[model samples]
Target: MSGSRSVADRSRPVDGKRVVVTGAASGIGKGVATALVQGGARVVLLDRNVDAVTAVADELGATAIGCDVTDEDQVRAAMRGAAEHLGGLDGAVNNAGIVLNEPAESMSLVDFNRVIAVNLTGVFLCAREQFPFLADGGGSIVNTASMCAGIVVRPQPQVSYNASKSAVVGLTRSLAAEWADRNIRVNSVSPGYTLTELVRSPELAPQHEQWSSLTPMKRLADIDDLVGAYLFLLSDQAGFMTGQDIVIDGGYTVW
Candidate 1:
């Protein structure tokens, strides 16, 4: 009669959890949504690109909603739609981001503010709308940040990107603390040099290569490679985890 228990003591786990993933039409968001679906969760894919989102949603048989993440009204409507379609919302991935790569000197206020608005304000808007839905089920949130949050990513100075992602880390922690009593866990994943369509662009590939070389892995990460971390954060397996930024940067921050 010690601390041991029978096999039945184990919980049924995170199967059947309903999660909303923004920017799910492609890249890391799509990968996370796909992984969650394969693991038996109901996923709602929200993206600004309606056609691509529709195609992906059709392929995955998930509910798809097209909305601009930066628009508060659209973000709220999307969350409402997700709640209505999924019957209830359990979690969300605030992964919609825009990258503007230019030298800081040449970067204009308009360009800088645009990136901040989408990357930082967008995450806040999504989370603000999603909290009530998720609180109903007491769930987890995993935001997609970047290695630039903690590290000095020089040579290709994306000052706005760096600032926005750093703010994400802070926001995740703050929200985690604020909602701990409600059993709403908040966390983030900071991926480094992830290979996406954006990375493959002629303007970004060389920078991507440079960043990849900086990582100990010596290669850029596939979007799928970041899936496990998201899964773990959203699943009950990480129940004790909150207010943490799980860096999946292949040791890029070590230097």
Candidate 2:
């Protein structure tokens, strides 16, 4: 009781909380990890990139695990380790994902399944594995969905990516309802098109113009622009919120 915090302090937007973040070695994950540390939360960074994640952990004074979300064994092991390190799990940000830009006509089953595995199945695994850890403390879960989940990406082919993201939305809603009794709120953030290494690829560069034009804001989202939504969802401030999709798309989905 000597080190205990007041209720108000714990309820203030992720203060002194412990959280696990997937894909946390770089990009949006890195941004979230940085913000979480600044906001006073102990963060566990998980990613497929071992060295990179470890380096990030050292830099941020956070825990790091090299767990690929698509692999159940690795995820389980990582969660166990994270819980051990943090004393318990209070929330998680499942942000690990990949994208494929193949046309439906030429898309192979293997490639399509790969996308689903990482984007859809990965989320499912994280949520399921996180339940045991979160239920005890009334935890929060925020999955990274996309505006493409609700709206189609144009001037390119990404049928697999679109389908996978769409499934994430449905998954979030279904789990939110079923898990409400445990006080484990579930929600998602649909970032329009955030500026990150993934989006800065030479192949995706051309599509940037189309994506910006579609959004009334005339620009893609920066990682800075999207971390706040995630921070809110994983905080007690969103206690009354669940089964929701906070679309930070700059009005892209509005049209």
Candidate 3:
């Protein structure tokens, strides 16, 4: 915000970085976007929920768009808008997702497909669209996979969710390899049970309690706990890293 700042002060890992975050209207998306803006990144917040995203963006002095990641046209359009707002893209966070806890046998195909579309296909679309904008400068992409990707020991059934997230790990690796030549880095952050609005739901209380108990930390992770990993991956600090899944599951998958 001031021109008197020195280069080092202005060039902090996320400082002045142009980034796009999906699902920025609420929950984890909202938390990450807030952190980025505070850390000096110019963020373009995208979400299907127009009203909510607009409000949040305005509050943070960031740009906002009402676009669905599942739609190619909207994804392209959102990227275009982001470029216009931030001059160009430097990084992206594909954090848009949904969850359905139901028996695999009884889960309707429609329900399973919906979760995959948002959690899996959505990330693919966001990354693909943002690739062109980021390729010129060689940037970073962080997708939100879950501890469920590796551990499915919970009593509740999340077959579809687990399957989709596991695929994200594979997806991150493949993209990292392909983009490495362009100086682009791709990675994922697998968060443990976090205390977000969604996770704190009355319906999810039992699951939260169970996960909290099982976690080695004996407590759930806060959204802020996962921000450092994203910032590191987006910054030059992780210049040598790519195609890696940084698991921040509070040692949940270690056992």
Candidate 4:
């Protein structure tokens, strides 16, 4: 106990950290940004939906940037802008992603490539651009993967999504190993079916019951349920962790 920090000190692990979150217009990204702000971190919210993200940032008293992660130039510029706003970066959450539920046999190449461009290549671009800002003092990068990365779900043919997410894990491990020397720890979070705006839509609501029953917890996760993992990955408490994926699936993958 002589060298130990108090629980109070440990409780606000991300306090004063400079952080950035992509896809911050809604869903998990917005949830994480809100938590970061509440935890006393300086945050920059980026999303392709400029107006929406701007509103969220304004509400949270954080900076906002219009960025499309799949575009390299945009990613680079957004990172620079975020670092400038934060004065430097301590952590980043690369969470911009889209899923297309089409069977592989009928899925057009254009559609498949779109998913890869955003979910896989976009992550690479963000991490690459964030390197310079973080290299000086070291930082963390949390990529949002999905439980689909590990196992294919039934009733949905999202071959592209599954493939892209699986690659994210591989990318995370590669970056973690390569950047360990620079103190840039890389990690990923793979969430199970979560209750996001899109999921609550009338078109997708019918599928919720099936998804919930399959989960061990008998329900979908709230955005709140997954934000803690992101906060931990970006905090000093997880200082020794890297190249790992924290799956927040409520035991869905346990089977």
Candidate 5:
């Protein structure tokens, strides 16, 4: 009881925190950033699309930085910029990623490597750069993984995506362990197929029924459904939690 915090403190843990979110121009990243701002956190939105991200940042009253996560130099600059904008960093969401639905048998090496570079290596670069800013006060880092890391989805042959996401889980655990002494908590959120813009496109709309039928919840997740887990990880409520993956897949992986 001596060290316990009030319920209000735990409930509004992310208020006044300085947080950065990558790939924030759309989808899950945008949803998380919006939530952070609404929760009273100073947020910086980062994405390779400068115009789009800047627009979103302006709309949300947050800062924006154009950063291609796959590029180390760009990632370093973006992290520094975010730190400067917010005075320092308290949390980071490494959510930049890509997926290709190419068949493994005929997938070009270039295509495979490109996915790895963005999805896996990009996370490593962002986390590595964020360490310096977060090390000072013991911050949290949340990486975006996928339910595909545990089980492959049907009707799609995305070997590269599956492989990259699986590695993200491993990377999250490794970083959490290595940085525990520095008091930097690292964790991941693995969301099942969400109805993001890409997923809502005409090309993929036909597959929605198939995807929904596979989930025990009988539906896909909404961006709102997944942002709460990210907010929790970034808050002091999860002070002792690290190196864990919160899978929000509507029971898709259960089967």
Candidate 6:
């Protein structure tokens, strides 16, 4: 068998599967959606950025719905909207998050709450709404966590971001355990400093060179590089894997 043949075989379809991806307008969420579509799942994009979400859905021929995940009502409505648009829902990726840099001593309550609202509360909202849709036949869920959840950060502070993401890991484990008998698999992916909008911030740009050098891969990850783990968790390949956190950091956490 040729190498090309093996590659082609690996690209098999995930037909008849339905997936909802929040934060689908950009970054890692967008990449995950694209990969699901390529693998033959029908995808519904939920994003607070209506225009970008619609544009991406149009480009991918998937359905798009406007949603502010931090709001319970909006999150419920968005989940319903996606279920209706896609005819059903089988899986979800809770990838919506926000980050704010502040020294712990100086971090205001408002800033801290904002990050927690979107990164942590948003996950709760989505998972709460997803239950009814996913319970029947069981389904998969993958949350976007961060390397900061497991490792310490230095030089730049994201105390709020780190705390919220750590909650995500806890959420994944609890949900996975609760839903295990029901066959609803739950997992999380923790990424290190990857090439995303967050990395281009003026505050963090100076550290990019250091971050890259620190990684064993010696490069920042492309958003797409995280897709395979998602596909696995959503597929039978990882049917037995749940309540786990998969770290994809280009080996940045090894040291």
Better of 1 and 2 by TM-score: 2
Question: Mind giving the per-residue lDDT tens digits that candidate 2 earns over 1-255?
Answer: 253546776656788788999999999999998999999999999999999999999999888999999999999999889988999989899999898888999999999999999999999999999999999978999999998899787877899999998999999999999999999999999898999987888899878988899889999999999999999989877888999999998888888
> Candidate 3's residue-wise lDDT over 19-107, tens digit each?
99999999788998998998889999999999999999999988899999899999999998898789989999999988888899999
lDDT (Cα, 0-100) at 60 in candidate 5? 98
**Cα TM-score per model:** 0.94, 0.95, 0.94, 0.97, 0.98, 0.94
216 Cα displacement, candidate 6 (Å): 2.1
> Candidate 5's residue-wise lDDT over 90-179, tens digit each?
999999888888889999999999999999999999999999999999999999999989988999889999999999999999999999
Which regions of candidate 3 are displaced past 4 Å? Answer: 1-11
**Native-vs-model 4 lDDT?**
0.95
Q: Best to worst by TM-score, what's the order?
A: 5, 4, 2, 3, 6, 1
Each prediction's number of clashing residue pairs: 0, 0, 0, 0, 0, 0
Q: Clashes in model 1: which pairs?
A: none
- List clashing residue pairs in candidate 5: none
Of 2 and 3, the candidate ranking higher by lDDT: 2
Weakest 10 consecutive residues of candidate 5 by summed lDDT: 1-10
**What digit string (tens of lDDT, one per residue) describes model 6 on residues 1-255?**
323334443555355679999999999989999999999999999999999999999999988999999889999999988888877778999999888989989999999999999999999899989988899889999999999888776668889999999999999999999999989999999988878877788988888888888889999898878888888787755767999999999998898
lDDT of 3: 0.89
What TM-score does prediction 4 earn?
Answer: 0.97
What TM-score does candidate 2 reach? 0.95
Q: What's the distance in Å from true for residue 211, model 2?
A: 1.8
List, residue by residue over 158-189, the lDDT tens digit for candidate 1: 88999999999999999999999889999999
- What lDDT does each candidate get? 0.87, 0.91, 0.89, 0.95, 0.95, 0.89
Model 1, position 94: C-alpha lDDT score: 94
Query: lDDT of model 5 at residue 139?
Result: 95
Cα lDDT for residue 25, model 5? 99
